[model samples]
Target: MTGASPLRPDEAALREAIVHTAREMERLGINQGTSGNVSARCADGLLITPSGVPATALHEDAIVWLPLDVAADAPVLSERKPSSEWRMHRDILRARPELNAVVHTHSVAATAMAIHSRDIPAHHYMVAVAGGNSIRCAPYATFGSQALSDYAVAALQERYACLLAHHGVIAASATLSRALWIANEVEVLAKQYLLASQLGTPPLLSDDEMAEVLEKFRNYGMRGTSGNGAH
Candidate 1:
């Protein structure tokens, strides 16, 4: 608890969700220590987990409040320093209005694939969950730079998830849970792809096949939405 005083009830709840999402990432083994970050849109900005702080030790007020237009040197404005990847989170949240939550993780399998600069092909139907036939791997960049954020935005084209080369995985969605779910699913796909590679290249589904699956997802996949299923 620090500067800028208190949070409204809903904002407080969102902070709690951010913390819970971060903790869940570790428990699911998709993240470790302070290796990942989580955030959700609020008011005119986003509430992101602070830098180098373990999720289990996070408290609501310790979350960093980054205005969408926060200046580069204004990290001091927030009570705590935002995550080192704050640039990526800020860029994604600002660029994708439909996505309210963003989660970045160094999940083992996903990062392993990223290190190889391998994109996950549509070898599985669930690959369409990311809104494409494949999950892309962004080119490598310094961890906390605008260059990394630029690469991430490009790689996430038409998709909710992407792999950061030599770094980790990142996913953004309309909700905290959905973003985390997408990250987890990305890791699963990465693991499957790696295992299958050992037995020779996996047969990829055709474009038409993925198209049909995407259409079905648009119709009945979501409880009450369009093309918004978990897949």
Candidate 2:
């Protein structure tokens, strides 16, 4: 079963969400031009951002739809080329079945942190958005290649998000909206960490403390807590 049986009716909603999120990223200065791509798994196929298209100019029909199954060297749904990083997107979906949405961004801070010698420590609880610890950066790989896809899959093991060294950040979630939110949160946290480090050795949370917060987060609903306890 292709993840909820391809909601054709939901395609409009999905397209709108992708367009809005891409525009939002540009507005927030997280993505520039058409440097990043986003995708959401649908029952019919995967809905992905078309390559070389500016976020501001993306229309609903401009979004490319690729079938979950590869058929005769083409996607069953359309003839258009998928994202340049389609393999990475496909691998992420294959590895994390629960993840319905994936957001990849070329944000400055996160990309900078990805190339750093040290891992990003859990300095704040917001890191829980990335599986409740710290985001791991996958080793550097040539973009748009199987090596990069494999590296991303490895880094995403047991985590909801990962950074691509010298490239960008990738975040996945059960929903497209949540994935976008988490991606934004990651960039924010990365920027904060970068700034703090410039101030001469930022304080990091201890392992025990991070574990405690992660446990608490699990009880509070691992996704996130709403204003009410309904989460």
Candidate 3:
């Protein structure tokens, strides 16, 4: 038989962070009622937002905890169902062991950019927040499906964030709060790019310049700071 999984004291902390950040996202207009979900890795499993539940109403106990090793047929942790996109969270955690948190949201600017025919360029230094050189958008796929998960994983290659075509954005990080911070920064950048593009052609940083910025990100004080800059 498989060994019993260990418990995680950090699970409660993660749950609270998810709820709090989800509300923040809503307040900032990054997410709407019941439209976004956040997940974080726990020692034994995962903590995730419940489906069809608004961020404004989330409670700690209301969050769902799914055992990582549980049989697919086994009962889930809460009476409230887990997010339909749990599969995406599962795949990301399985593929990127270093990532502790995953956030998916339908923020306006990011989603608008995702619908464009091209990738979101790293024209600015802040692009490093999402990892690698640029933010990529995965091809459109039905939400909550394996196809979507596969596309997201593929787009996330060597990157911490990706835009879901016709859908939203996904960002992962080493901590729950950091993940949320990156997601927020991505939206802000998207908004800037949109406005800049309308004002005329936006100057884009060259590949070498972006590389330098990414290198700097490794030592940047903001790299892992969280909770509205509380650090």
Candidate 4:
């Protein structure tokens, strides 16, 4: 069911955060117009950005509350419709309880790489922060379709970020800011990868080395709160 109730104090704050994040994405230049969406987990559902709304026009009340258990294609009851990618956000939050926020972007570089269906390997050690040595690209599926949501869930199985083939990027984390950070980082990585390709194949970190980095990230904290290794 789409939750249309008045927001509780905490829910209100969460809704505001989602609106802020949706705008932040635009300011960061990782998203444009209304091509991306942001959401934060709330009481039995998620507060997602409204469909087709530009960031400048977004507001707390415009956020749509979608229950985690509702069917992906179920008719929404809210005054505003949730983003078309709401199912992807909902499924990820349901499958990864540790993650509370999800950011989906059509960032240029990342989408360029996604259009080619490429994975971002551990060419830089920082890739470990995403919980793996590589950010996989989920095979393409039509936007708003269940198949796309299924593909996203599978690609994010052991990673917090993934590229949707021919589409864009998905970055999810324990907090909205952290998820946004990952989204930006993925775009940076994609840009760097494309630039480095000019010098032939870029040297990649070995699996053993990536494993060590992953361990270190785990110990130092994958979340940005620690401020140790996280960006």
Which candidate number has the best lDDT? 4
Give a tens-digit lDDT track for model 3, residues 27-82. 87889999989988887577788888999888887677776654435656334478
Identify the runs in model 4 with alpha carbons over 4 angstroms from their true place. Answer: 1-7, 72-79, 223-231
**Which one wins by TM-score: 1 or 2?**
1
Candidate 4: the clashing residue pairs are none
lDDT per residue for candidate 1 within 63-164, as digits (tens), equals 888777776777454556889988898899989888899999999999998999989999998888788889999999999999999999999978889999
Winner on TM-score (2 vs 4):
4
Stronger candidate by lDDT (1 vs 2)? 1
What TM-score goes with each of the models?
0.92, 0.88, 0.89, 0.94
Clashing residue pairs for model 1: none
| Overall local distance difference test of candidate 4 | 0.87
lDDT of 4 by residue, 42-151 (tens): 88888888889999998888888888876744777444588988889889999999889999999999999999999998888887767799999999999988899999
lDDT of every predicted structure (CA atoms) = 0.85, 0.78, 0.80, 0.87
Ranking by lDDT: 4, 1, 3, 2
The TM-score of predicted model 3 comes to 0.89
Model 2 residue 6 CA deviation in Å: 6.6
After superposition, the stretches of candidate 2 with alpha carbons farther than 4 Å from their true spots are 1-7, 75-78, 224-231
Candidate 3 residue 228 Cα shift, in angstroms, is 7.8
lDDT of 2: 0.78
